[model samples]
Target: MTSPTGEPARTRGPEGPDAPANPLTRLPLDELRRRTSMKWRTYPPDVLPLWVAEMDVPVPPPVARAITDALALGDTGYPAGTVYAEALDAFARERWDWDGVVAERTAIVPDVMLGIVEVLKLVTDPGATVVVNSPVYPPFYAFVEHMDRKVAEAPLDPYGRIDFAALEITFQEAAAGGRRAAYLLCSPHNPTGTVHSRAELAAVAQLADEYGIRVVADEIHAPLVLRGARFVPYLSVPGAESGFSLMSASKAWNLAGLKAALAVAGPGAAADLARMPEEVSHGPSHLGVIAHTAGLREGGAWLDALLAGLDENRTLLADLLADELPQVRHIAPQATYLAWLDCRDLGLGDDPAARFLDRGRVALNSGTAFGTGGAGHVRINLATSPEVIKEAVRRMAASLG
Candidate 1:
């Protein structure tokens, strides 16, 4: 199949070999605007929305079929068994070559954020401190505060990598007075798209162990690691045996609305994970489990195609910024579809996203909300067609005039 621009499309449905080439190109702008999702409904029809992490791609054929089959059978009820965990285990084993996700040691939760909250409860108290690397997903602050936990920032280095010295200082401060602490690690980090290396994860595990801090990794973006990068499961790290990890196909498969995730426990952390309330398992919907399971179990080919498209979009965006918005610094991401843009040199003040939305009619995520070091930046969702990316850049450049 070919796209509107006559380029070979890179998408495919469950329609065997006849599927299209690009998932991002499957849905056109008019069709997208008709949907009522947050990405589409958040802005007026004239504004091009690219703020949220939601991708502008069609549902994977296997995922759609699974949901359809379940609905046809009237299989809407509470989720049961360990099918989701088992599927994740298989995917991880094949993709990351790690088998730390033992079904017996995993629990199903509503989503990655909820799963994280539950895991944090198991290893931390209401008032305990949770350390985070700044300029991260904003929810890390909102959710942690909502759970009545204090937050300590361990800002990432200037290059967007983990700063060991800053982390150690934050750990010391958080663990002072013999207080229990937890480090919320964002593997294959959001916005920046910096995939943590195995050695880097090992270093993190080492720090957590020395500070007597428990680690809970949010590996939701693991499957979206584009190219030239690797995602290491936290539990697979040696010193992380006492740590926890929350993962889901939600981000990769655009299943956020389906709402199903797993909280995996390392060998040494099994007992603490076991203490989670039984009611927590009741949070996931039966249909969600079915869809996520199908995606993880049978959506491998679809995921690879999506990754290929995203890789292209990242490179396209870098080239666009260089030619049109040269003042905007874009560090091409190593993973995921989100692009972190440094607009500090654009002379648009802290929240350049506002200018882009107001003048350019393009909505991007304001970095200010992403916490410290987020000012003078905006996050652009690159999970769309190349045309949209090009247009967004054009609009951004026009906004400056």
Candidate 2:
């Protein structure tokens, strides 16, 4: 796993000069000129902002062209977006081989968060217990409370992995006298970046079926799986063919601001989708429908390249960590551009992230923000340039030197 510079850069995977790769990782030379000349009056110039999980790459060429083409027609209002809807259905079908009643099952929402809130309300009762794996996405907690339901925190075990043993006990305990109504399932779980295997999903489906619980799988991270891993859609699992799956191009393709997502329902999934708030979606932005369709349908090449770049960046971050700071344990992320670090040994006493940031001048997504299990960890996003990642690690080494 060592690079020519004696750093841990090359991770094990398919190797070759023509190895599948993304061309966007390389920052243009003109960036040097701009960096040399530019100055931001609002924030400090020295800040390496990797905390927000935004990619620095330009919008994929095809997506940009599609937007431009749409604008040329002066078609920008909420007049029947029939063509766009059709394109999205075809795109979803082709991309994931997910077949369903496209028009009936699918509806455009401004964001995935909105779709989730709607679904949570539909599945749970007032003061109902919604099971969640902590050290999870912040919004999972927010969405539960936002819908007037109580969140039952199921803390994942050490190494920041899911504790299925505890999960079973928790579910059983919740439904001791009656049925456990719902479970917020994060397939290709966020924060921890654990993409559940088919076997795991089957077990989950069995338990949910046993308890008569509704599972809402947030599958936004499915498309971002790295080289050696495969992302399995929860609803598509053999046992979960009757569950709900929430999907978006935002996580992988940087389409969040576009405001679009597809809420795929199972055979009996209509009740959940139908119960969603009516006013929440006037329908997604005109451009969101267009860009999402173009990206999903015509974006195969762009996606492949983007994944390659993410893989390379993942390697670079691991190497830097191995050489620059050995006490911080880490695992080769099965998927996603995120690198999870075990900073438990840092022994910073108070807030480890705060100390690391103060000393290294590197802003990381605080571990505590991900819930209890993330106490001594930080999620490092490698979805940016190698130079930027290296610099952040360099700063970390110096700060803790």
Candidate 3:
């Protein structure tokens, strides 16, 4: 099977009489519990945590070796050069047939959210409005507001695609009073896992251009796009040459702790990117750059295996919800390992995740935190073992009884 891009489909891992192992299955609950990441430590020992975006897999060998080698040589200083951007360019070219990422037009930042804040700073003033499609990643509001920028939401359409009419209205309002505005786009949207089609993104670029709004995109989950959907980098679209993008291997490779990300500027936005403070580049850890560079350059096979596992998990989750909790509406995600479940039918008003955490002992992200159109829903992380997913469903069902 082939994807729309003509690349061989990654719906399943390498298959033979002896297939390559799935990464999600490699770590058991006992082993996972021994680690002390936020996903594991935020709740009690008894609770099943499916809330955070952290994956339940070990570090990919290539990334691990790179970080270890760096430490062995005591190469832990400030990050230097454009190696991270170069590696990402290679990955994008191979995986998405994109050649827009020039190392000279990219900057190293601490991570995706911080990178976004820094890029937003480049395009708009502190008091300007930053328009977003909600319910979006929670930090889109938090970080923008923290920087004294106001957030104006243009909620997604019912099927989780961009609502162009609402967006246009929001854009008009955001640009009112002759205020400089920016649009923060989350491609392959969080929680919903809705991968924006190229047409949709092109339309966005057109609208931003019409509204005199600058665009900044968070493309951190680009590599985690599953079998069916293709990730369209915002900067690759026409009329988007003035846009900015934030890319990272943290989510795809589960290296969030290492803390490295890139801020990529489209050709027309190169001058804006150049205006970014030199101190911002100092924020990324040297080890993080090495780890992310290695992952982007050499971890393709591991990523494919992980995506295959996530594809299975996506289907498994839908089936489990259908059989065990018929009231829950599960839209199988097109990308990422997150599943957004609509539980309004269960009579678990506004925040179903709270009820699930309390009664089911299952920790999930509350939809309310994601802003407008988010109530009565919950986001579940499916990057764990199938056994854990099954247990979580059983507990959730039992809670209703």
lDDT of each: 0.89, 0.71, 0.91
Top candidate on lDDT is: 3
Q: TM-scores of the models, in the given order?
A: 0.95, 0.87, 0.97
How do the candidates rank by TM-score, highest first?
A: 3, 1, 2
Tell me how far candidate 3 lies from the true structure as C-alpha RMSD in angstroms: 1.9
Which has the higher lDDT value, candidate number 2 or candidate number 3? 3
* Rank order (by lDDT, best first): 3, 1, 2
N/CA/C clash count, model 1:
7
- Tens-place lDDT digits, model 2, residues 13-75: 434675535544656524522442122122255666566656666677778988899899876
Q: Pick the candidate with the highest TM-score.
A: 3
Which 10 consecutive residues of model 1 have the lowest summed lDDT?
Answer: 4-13
- List candidate 1 segments past 4 Å from native: 1-20
User: Which pairs of residues collide in model 3?
Assistant: none
The parts of candidate 2 lying over 4 Å away from their true place are 1-43, 79-97, 159-161, 176-180
Quote model 3's TM-score. 0.97
Q: For model 3, how does the per-residue alpha-carbon lDDT over 259-332 read when each residue is reduced to its tens digit? A: 99999999999999999999999898889999999999998888888988998899899899999999998678
